[model samples]
Target: MDVNTRHVLIAGGGYVGMYAAFRLQKSLRKEIRRGEVTITVVEPRSYMTYQPFLPEAAAGNLEPRHVVVPLRRVLPDVQVITGRVVGIDHAEHTARIDPRDGAAYDVHYDELVVALGSVARTLPIPGLAERAIGFKQVEEAIQLRNHVLDRLDVAESTTNEETRRRALSFVFVGGGYAGVEALAELEDMARYACRYYRNFRAEDMRWVLVEAAGRILPEVGEDMGRYTVERLRKRHIDVKLNTMLESCVDGHVELSDGTRLDSDTIVWTAGVKANPVLAESDLPRDDKGRLPTEPDLRVVGAEHVWAAGDCAAVPDLTGPPNAVCSPSAQHAVRQAKVLGDNVARALKGRLLQNYEHKHVGSVASLGLHKGVAQVYGIKLRGWPAWFMHRTYHVSRMPTLNRKVRIVADWTLGLFFPREIVSLGSLQRPREEFERSALPRQFSPPASRSPELESAHAGGRPEQDGK
Candidate 1:
């Protein structure tokens, strides 16, 4: 180990952690070649999931593999640890690394980057955890896709009306970008999938979206939001506004508006809070459990520490005082670039630039050729918004390889019909292995077994031989 060398430790590999590492690795290439600085990224998953494309992936519009950026492939120069940074002790300049296997150990670092990201902000509604699926990662998206298709199968096969009705009913909680896009795309896919079913029609299936707020997708203007609601309603999709999910006990969904329905699928996408592991440290955090960062992406009053993305509350310079950046992918990718540059500047003893970016508006897709967007104060709906949504995300997606692959997927979708098969077994990849690992049960010789059985049954062992 070089005594003069500096180690940069990152706590995640999502938008912020991955892109920040890329920037630092590229900017500090010379320092890294000379072994003067080392960058290590600790993340539970080895790949970074491009969340915006998850809805499409779930709808079979894009391959799931293309939606994730392999951290090792993208950041070859940086040390990628496939584990988690469970604890951070900035006082000693050390972080506790809990690897995928073995015991947790501490790793020393000269600089620390907290880009741990966020987790689903869920409520304590009855049976929520047991029934609801969250659409945060690629696996969850894949699982949800399979689950929905499997529900259709159950509906077609079931003899009882109640059972079939429950199987056909799909409920999505929270009307934010995730819930809305996921529900719409999946519904479109499922509706089209009905072409193969013998007994079910798309109209027979009930798709419901429950939102607690007055409007959904507050990211765009109220008009665009209402228009989105109208589009969904026109599709015969139930869009419940100003309604709360009171309870979902045993698949019975009870709403605040006194509406009740039985649904097998319940997706939770209400919101996300900062990663909870940030609270384990003595580091300063805001009320929302996020690191309060300066305009330069530095953790407030914390030495050699920088934070960004959903995990950090970076002050929004373009907004009024006390306003922090939103936890959107747009902000996160931009923040990572600036944060990485500032980190490099700090290490090289140069002037650090403050991280600042104005909100560039938002875009969301409803279904294929259907969307709503407000970019630069100009509004778009239907196909244009859908195209813009895809264009922006593909351009923002990290690495040229992934960008090309995603585009290729889109090209394929144009020529081929959407895939409707469900691979739910992908969720339990280890099930087959576990079944194989079971101890073998071999029968002893018949005479030997019979002697033991006869003895236990009050007959002599010699009698069995006779």
Candidate 2:
């Protein structure tokens, strides 16, 4: 092993990957500048999403771009590859990189960081793959915002009772932070947007939150969870506990308790499982497809390899016996700092430290000026809780630049109102261009030239059958 040269290849530029690499490059600046050490990060997207703000982003409280930190911009000293690591051969220290185009290539490394993070945990319910949307990324968040507002557009225009009902109905599965926050924020936004619509009213829109478990936000303990339920119910948001989505075939949602709903917007935030890419890796993984890692964030029984974030089953030192860390943002960011430091310590043959942090309580924002939180055993709800939620998350928004921008957005929102434009066309940006790109001979009748329109309508004198 050459001590003079080292290359660290980090897979999945999420919380763990980006932070770990950033730490390495920053800590080993001289080594990197001397060309003795190198760091490379490969991920599908070029940014790391500060997921906590995604709800606000979706609800128009925050801009979509502010939620994501550009991996290349943040980790300027490190190499950032925009691609996917399809396979990892830890023993050989090579990972198969699949770019957007061209053949898959291999990148050799001195150390491997498996930080692929988690993917949406989807069930095999009918129509789930097609109709159900996720709330994991900024793209999905904004898409949901556009989609929910578009549904409002659909409901306001259609006179068909069934169509209007379906368009106005929204069903959200799962009741964790993601599910609750997204449902609350979007419902608030939609209700606010309705003040401008003639046919829209708070009573007309039906919002339902379904949770398979008997309680929602189980992390916040039973009492706070109940309070959350009560608050939601008061807002006319139906909170259904002990229920499962049995089937959702063709927008007809069937609950386990035999309830049915016709909902055009079905957002799925049930849970998250380990990234499936770990299945292709040569590293040791648990039955749940997560890397089995020690408290030090090193993968068990694997040399030159480490893992963290949602994809690693890191032993919880601060919890009870035989306990493991829960896959939460709190743990991911903290574990990342330790993971990076431990990796740096390893290069210098120094002793490694175990990652341990007591589980602080949780915080969740229901909507603007509304939230619930349990911090340091003290329970808080409504405005103070919402304030804490925003404060904590903004302070943890990675770079100071993003934090400032987010605060600016909130400050601006204080005096001004949120823009409720759908921008659904942003999804299909080429539609107008594509329409114009069509030749006159191939254009639609309404958009065709006058002569072409007459010809297309069979009104030409030569084509007349008289």
TM per prediction: 0.92, 0.93
RMSD (CA, Å), candidate 2 to true, equals: 4.4
Cα lDDT tens digits, model 2, 1-466, are 2566799989999999998998888778888888888899999999999899999999999999999999989898988888999998887889999987789999999989999999999999999998999999999998999999999999899889899899999999999999999999999999999998887687899999999999999888899999999999999999999999988889999999889989989999999999988999888988899899988999999998999999999999988987899999999999998999899899878999999999999999999999999999999999999999999999888889998999999999999998899989999999999999887764474656777766768877354565
Q: Please give, for residues 1-466, the per-residue lDDT of candidate 1 as tens digits.
A: 6789999999999999999999999999999999999999999999999999999999999999999999999898999999999999989999999999999999999999999999999999999999999999999999999999999988889889999899999999999999999999999999899999987788899999999999999999999999999999998999999999989999999999999999999999999999999988989998899999989999999999999999999999999989999999999999999999999999999999988789989999988999999999999999999999999999999889999999999998889998888787877889999999999997666667766988877987784455
Q: TM-score of the candidate numbered 1? A: 0.92
* Residue-level lDDT for 176 in candidate 1: 95
| Runs off by more than 4 Å, candidate 2 | 1-4, 439-466
Name the 10 consecutive residues with the lowest summed lDDT in model 2: 441-450
Predicted structure 1: lDDT? 0.94
Candidate 1 C-alpha error for residue 156, in Å = 1.4
Collision pairs in model 1: none
Error of model 2, residue 52, in angstroms: 0.6
